[model samples]
Target: MSHEFTVEAGLVIFSYDGRAQFGWLDLKTGAYHAESDGRCIPDAIGAIEFHSDVTH
Candidate 1:
């Protein structure tokens, strides 16, 4: 199964191989800011950190 979703600037995708990859998306334009390179948690964590910094 494959799926794609966005949480804030974070983009998460689950591929047919059952691997979850991470990337970034431009919030305003809703375009991809970065392509998924098989990264996972760390990329997501970075997005969360960025969001926290902006919201605080």
Candidate 2:
């Protein structure tokens, strides 16, 4: 599904209800890269760190 979107500065703004989020979209691959709050581990390094943490 495609959402209505726009580009401001360098970020792609998008939403379904007008309350939107900003991110960098790869036009060639349709990948959206956004800032993380450090809670999501999308890489091997992050997965390793999260796996090694005893407090989780």
Candidate 3:
């Protein structure tokens, strides 16, 4: 499956099959994908979410 968040934070791709995974993140460029660990996302999600001070 996939997920997309429409905001100044750009889009996040949430994917899963038998295990949890993430990808396609722009990160420092201000746009990114859910390709890592993050605070805003669920721990089980195994995805990267943005921080309050997310810099570009």
TM-score of each: 0.28, 0.31, 0.19
lDDT of each: 0.40, 0.34, 0.40
- What shift in Å separates residue 33 of candidate 1 from its native position after superposition? 9.1
Model 2 stretches with alpha carbons more than 4 Å out: 1-8, 37-56
lDDT tens readout by residue for model 1, 1-56: 26543434444544445555445655584443335353233223222223212211
How does residue 38 of candidate 2 score in lDDT?
A: 21
Task: Give a tens-digit lDDT track for model 2, residues 1-56.
Answer: 25643423544344434433434454595554443432221221111011111221
Full ranking by TM-score: 2, 1, 3
- In model 3, residue pairs whose N, Cα or C atoms come closer than 3 Å (at least 3 residues apart or on different chains), thus clashing, are 25-33, 26-32
TM-score, cand. 1: 0.28
Give the count of colliding residue pairs in each prediction.
Answer: 0, 0, 2
lDDT of 1 at 30: 42
Q: For candidate 1, which ten residues in a row score worst on lDDT?
A: 47-56
Error in Å for residue 40 of model 3: 23
Error of 3 at 10 (Å): 3.5
Model 3 CA deviation exceeding 4 Å by range: 1-7, 18-52
